[model samples]
Target: MTIDDHKSHLVTLGKFLKQFQVTGSKKDEEIPGNDRFFEDFDQKIDNAIHYNGWFTRENIIFALQQWSEALTPQNLKWWLGDYNLNQSGGKTVGIVMAGNIPLVGFHDFISVLVSNHKVLVKQSSHDKQLLPVIAAYLMNLDSRYENRIEFTKGKLEDFDAVIATGSDNTARYFEYYFKGKPSIIRKNRNSVAIITGNETKEELAKLGEDIFRYYGLGCRNVSKLYIPKDYNFDNFFQAIYEWNPIINREKYANNYDYNKAVYLMSEFKLLDNGFLMLKEDKNFGSPIATLFYEIYSDETELEKNLEEHSEKIQCVVKLHPGKKEVKFGHTQKPQLWDYADNIDTIDFLSIL
Candidate 1:
């Protein structure tokens, strides 16, 4: 099919989103996954075995807007230079996804799709329910595409190009298993933020979602806060406390207990209100909803160290110093225009 042929299909999917009520109303169900997406948005997002848990209607709105901004026609043209269906390209690919986070695998999934390649996917059992629901709607837009993508249970060995996401440990398995194919192997990663003294209450609340939502089980969640030695914990703690209603959980007990134990072992020097955990550590990442802090006397010195780990950092959470978004959240809660891996993902998709 020609670019002209596929362009309308994309538009149709966006329209079907509203027709079917998939993602959200901010953009209308016309887009794609608008209502169901929002249904999942307001529904309980925590599926312990599946990190894809934790998203709100607002989160979906933010993400949808960002995606729309980044996928403009001119930008798509500039990004996807030559890959065309008319040229009868290579066999394209398949993706064995990760359930560690919500649609974390969509980047490569769409990349292969936009490249006009056949994507045979082995959906994580946890996500078996989501992508399929989305596909059912997409199929409504174009039956031609319905058969083009699939959800299966199998090994990644059958594909020409494969991308797999898993823990850092599973990377060795992915490397040896898919060694001969055109592939990208992604492993575990976590995001962090720099908490300047000037953040607003709104920013603090959003940051709380970034850190505590999904119980800190995703790579994009801010696991650590960069602060000056003189920083006071009141505003941060107060903001979190305001939303204390979010902590009513059977699963949160494990993290609460563990963090409490760690604190108790340290002589309870750290007083937590049973919401977020705080401790001293050099690492920007932490386990669960716990946050690690490295109180630096000098912000300049702290930033230099962070630069060394730039590859590990996802979002800065704030602009200069005064007022901006204030804080950041997990990658699960991205704005539509936000780039993934700090790279213009849509542009990258165009080139592939």
Candidate 2:
């Protein structure tokens, strides 16, 4: 299929996804092939929740909504506009996906296909349900997509290049295994929010979305906080109280109970709000129900320190007026052009 054909299929897929939202699923008959695919796709969402405890219906719908917004004609054009994708055919790209969040490997999947390359995906066991349904929808849109998308059960063989996401440990294996091929090996990276004392309650509340969304499973979720020394957290706690319902989830509550007990038994000082724990840690990756934080005396020094550890961070959350730092609550809503790990997927594919 040509690039425009791919774009049109994706735009239709986005329209299908737009029907499923956090509030409710409202079918729009205007989308092509909806009659054949809509009911099955709705059922698959429930099947996904049944398969993965972490994949709540709300989180899955949120992911769908984000993708729906991203796949618009305008967004897709802007994302691929700068690249000369005409040179981007005749390769099979293997993707080793991470199952931490819903459709986490989708960006890479679409990147390869939109660049006119075939994709071989080895899905994480935790999240194997949804994408194939999507692939089917795309294939229904155009029979050509059937030739472009493939899922592997054994190993990612017979591929020219690869993109893999995993822990820091698995990265070594990916590097060693794919050494002969052009690849993007992604390691563990966490996001952090810089809490200036001046942020309004509204902004801090928005920051709560950054923390609690996906039950803190996504790398884009802010796991660490950089706050001013002697900063009072009373307002911050109050602002985030809207998400207190998150603790009601059994898995999250269990983690909270386990981690809280471990912290108390160890005599580590903590700030507790019944649901979430705040620990004064210099690390970026925190546990499921806990948030790590450190105090910064100067913004300049803090920026330098973060830059020094840039590889450890996925993205920075801050409320600077003119600076391009990610705003509060928008970490999970990254634009289509916001390439993960600052690596340009299209650029990588176009050259290959």
Best by TM-score: 2
Residue 266 shift from truth in candidate 1, angstroms: 5.8
| lDDT of candidate 1 over 115-198, digit per residue (tens) | 566778888765554465555555655676776787778664456767677777888998998887766666666676777788
Give lDDT for model 2.
0.92
Candidate 1: misplaced stretches above 4 Å? 4-7, 15-89, 266-269, 319-339, 342-352
Residue 313, model 1: Cα distance from true site in angstroms: 2.5
How many clashing pairs per prediction, in order? 27, 0
TM-score of 2: 0.98
- Candidate 2 residue-wise lDDT, 1-352, digit = tens: 7778888999989999999977778989899888998899989999999989999999999999999999999998898888898877899999999999999999999999999999999999889999999999999999988899999998889999999999999999999999999999999999999998999888899999999999999999999999998999999999999999999999999999999999999999999998999999998999999999999999999989988999898889987623447988899999988888989989999999
